[model samples]
Target: MLFRFLVFLYPVIRTLGPATAALLLIAGISLIGYAVLRQPGLWSWLAAGACLLSAGLLALLCHSYHWWLFKLRPHGSLFIPIK
Candidate 1:
């Protein structure tokens, strides 16, 4: 169930850019680690792990589409050329 949700998030994250994806991945891992050490319930652990996995997949997706993600935007023109 969680895996399916993460799969769906891949394309959304890919459009967000590598830096954002990487930051999210790092934050997710940190949260999972913190939960493992402080949380007592199995559900909490599973939830944290799912978040971490999702972030990791997002990062990978972003990296795979890096070039497309950072494509140059069209520049604005000062004035329209006379036809």
Candidate 2:
């Protein structure tokens, strides 16, 4: 029963997570554009770029979650998915 539930949930999660990350990235870019129009300052761009970079990094981390789990662990006691 649990296996079936997880099987169903996986696709839902796979679809939702990337969409959420994409929305975050879009919001970051739009904010940067708005900031440029409003203030046109160097420091503002730097800050907005930092925020955008962080969001991109977060999306990357999500995509590489299994790799990170394997890398962070001291011993390989569990099997990490290649997919």
Candidate 3:
């Protein structure tokens, strides 16, 4: 679910500059990880949300991805850069 939402939002985010988008994504994931560690019940909530909304949510996610970007080369501006 989280991945789907990220995919659905990434193109719009990339418009703000890919570097900014990537940094914001990294920060957001770090924050979410912290939150989950502080309150483990988040996993149960996530599971419940998944169970309740799986079908329509997945359909919307599939429809939302910007597939055309796949053809654009120089794809080496990696989102998760290697150290």
What TM-score, over all chains together, does every model reach?
0.46, 0.58, 0.28
Model 1 whole-model lDDT (C-alpha atoms): 0.58
Candidate 1 residue runs with Cα over 4 Å from true position: 1-15, 66-83
Off by over 4 Å in 2: 1-20, 79-83
* Candidate maximizing TM-score: 2
Choose 1 or 2, whichever is better by lDDT: 2
The order by descending TM-score is: 2, 1, 3
**Ten-residue stretch with the least lDDT total in model 2:** 1-10
Model 3 per-residue lDDT tens digits across residues 55-74: 34434434544443343323
Tens digits of lDDT, candidate 2, 1-83: 54334344555546675776777678778878877789787876777777678678767766875555556544546544434
lDDT of each: 0.58, 0.65, 0.48
Q: Is candidate 1 or candidate 3 better by lDDT?
A: 1
